[model samples]
Target: MGRAPCCDKANVKKGPWSPEEDSRLKDFIEKYGTGGNWIALPQKAGLKRCGKSCRLRWLNYLRPNIKHGDFSDDEDKIICSLFASIGSRWSIIAAQLPGRTDNDIKNYWNTKLKKKLMGMIPSTHRKPPPFPTIPLRTTPPPPSSSLSSLYNDCSPYYTSTNSLTGLESISAAPHNFLNTSTTTSLAINCSLLQTQDILLSPLQYYPVKDSLIMFGGDQASCSSSDGSCSQISYGKEIKQEDMGLHQSHMISNGFEENQRFMFDYGHNGSDHSLNTWSSTDLKPNGYLGNTALEYDLEEVKQLISSSSNGCNSFFFNDESKTQERALYY
Candidate 1:
């Protein structure tokens, strides 16, 4: 059997409401309110209308502060954004738009707004960009003599995404890049975050000839105590006076004559812009950072010729699996 009607169809009026009917519904509601039950409101107001019909008339047209007509651009944006997030929940969308009825928004979305938005939509005619090009490997994968024998295992090196991509381009670098079987390179990069047992370590120190992939991220990039800094030139020949080194460390590096060793660096332990590798960032007392030991020119030649720990053939590591390891200071 079909369900019973809300109000007797024979007794109640249907179709468009007249001016008198709209006035009666509006006057009755404003003075007494809905009294919590819309189903009984029409009967109480002595109207030959369905309770649902009276309610719809009051909410959609007769209500105070009721808005009608074209929506504004800001309103269009709000509707679009809300619709994208929650979809066709007309009542919720209406709540955000002050004075707009849910039925009105529903009608607007269905008959006009939906079509307007569709008209504004961009066409999918243009093709997507092509994938990047990586060169094919000319040589086989690297050997098993990985970086543990080279740079001692360190934590992850934090660099920009582009730097990491550069390192991954070439997996196997030449072993002789280290200049030492025991890894005497200046730069070191490593990470312990991955689950894979295999790691990739690509290292190239100062005076490295191969020019393997370099990853650069300096924790000391902000070595200045103030608020500004500049990169010190790598491989730049600095005089002893300009170098920000401790007096003892310089003495250990070997001193030929007092004037020659300390002249390049400033005499007052000052890291002047002129004396600097052009670095203006100095501690209040004047120190950029502890520089690597500066070996005397004569002593370096003597060490190269010495049989023990001599500057001899270099080395490096290339493995099957690869991870990027780069150290920049």
Candidate 2:
């Protein structure tokens, strides 16, 4: 059965709130408060509006200390950093900035901030560059070579090379190479490789035992000491039918296991710069640690500054231009 509606649909006013309606809502809430139920507040306030509409109007427009002026440069940094880290969790992002609401940030992001960021880069760099393919083989690595050393020999750019070993194509570049855009590219590439028939060369292959040894044998499955258990296949091809099962396995185990199987890259530093950012952290999240965070801020500032000369500039260096741009917000 269909659920009952919250209020009478035909009797309620639905369009933009009139000035008289706003005054009544503001006065009622100021005097009697919400009575702890938004669904019932509108009727008590003597308004014909829906409770949801009244709630939105009261919170977004009539709330005290709500700032509707232009967003500052620091606000822009906070928004961009939070967006890069958490992607569109507007309420969480809004919490970081006082007097700014989630709806305002979301609208600014969609209509202005997104376009400003995209316009900073050339059209060519916006698209992912072609990646080189690795040949498939079953040969083992040299006894003296470590996983970290082997991955370091790979190239950053996706270009063909004569090296027979498949390690040359993998990226061992520093964390600075991973910006918001490159991280996005990596995410796309990783998703495509998992779904598609892309193959990796033998040099990129590592036995389950090797992964256990490299990652300090901390994984639950790696705790087994039997030689037979260590011989389990690590880099076998996954068919489309097995994707769901594979994902379930990943959920049970963790993404680290999937990373171990898919990318043979190694972490060398004590800080583990290659580790992805944690979304829960209050600070800026960067794929490449502190360096990436700094780069992200600089990039945002540069883009905003460069766009000052445009017809619809959000940023202004001149004091005179600031007042003009302020009117648009």
Candidate 3:
């Protein structure tokens, strides 16, 4: 069955609000402050409008310090960045821009910002970019007696002294995945071979025993606080063929599907501009194909800038999954 309406439809004034109605809503809100219930606000304000309608009018139009008219370039960047990262969480996007409401941001995105971004890209190159190909270096496995021995030799960051059963065991205590204090030579060798060629999201950090454990995805990228030992961990089960497919799936399913707009800046020659920007501002030494080994505030600014230029892709689920293993650390 259909849910009942919040208010009576009959005898409620609709359409454009008159000056008198606007004045009453504004004055009532200014004096009484919505009385904490929008559904009961209309009658209290002596307006013939529906409570919902009155609320919309007051919030969108009559609210104090409400920003109207054109959106600034900075606001455009913030909206695009937040949208790319969080999808259509308009309220969260609105919070970043002062004097703007979720309704305003939504309307601007639908009518203006989306088109402005689309216009930045040439029409001929509108198709999705081919998935990035990362080449893995061939290195002889370290001379360890067995696979278990190798894992123990490489993973000095793990708090547990007992040998892990398998790759899945690493997942069981994902929190102790990287130790910042010590860098195992084997871990560096493994990291060098397993190239991180995609900038999927910002690098997130977790505090572990007076050290920081940096994580991005299943590929365990880490760096010490003192800027020593930038190493990433890869599961033994992950094959070269599987890495390509898995990274592609992570990009396609995790990000591309969430892109509300059809335009992709990565394909339309905008990557050069993005790369230039990141190189200059963020000082990211890695190539466009390689992900950043460390997180910086500047990288975030670059992400927002790239997003505004139409590179509408982002990383999610890093925080929740990290939190799940909080008990282990």
Question: Against the true structure, whose TM-score is highest?
Answer: 3
Candidate 2 residue-wise lDDT, 50-96, digit = tens = 88788778766776656797876556545654444334546555655
TM-score of each: 0.36, 0.41, 0.42
Return the TM-score for candidate 3, rounded to 2 decimals. Answer: 0.42
Better of 1 and 2 by TM-score: 2
| lDDT tens digits, residue span 3-70, model 1 | 89888889999999999998988888877887877778889998999988887787678776567888
Candidate ranking under TM-score, highest first, comes to 3, 2, 1
lDDT accuracy of residue 87 in candidate 3: 46
Ordered by lDDT, highest first, the candidates read: 2, 3, 1
Error of 2 at 225 (Å): 53
In model 3, what is the error at residue 187, expressed in angstroms?
26
lDDT of 1 at 93: 53
How do the residues 92-141 of candidate 3 rate in per-residue lDDT, one tens digit apiece?
45545555767888888876555443322223555522333222214533
Q: All candidates' lDDT scores?
A: 0.39, 0.41, 0.40
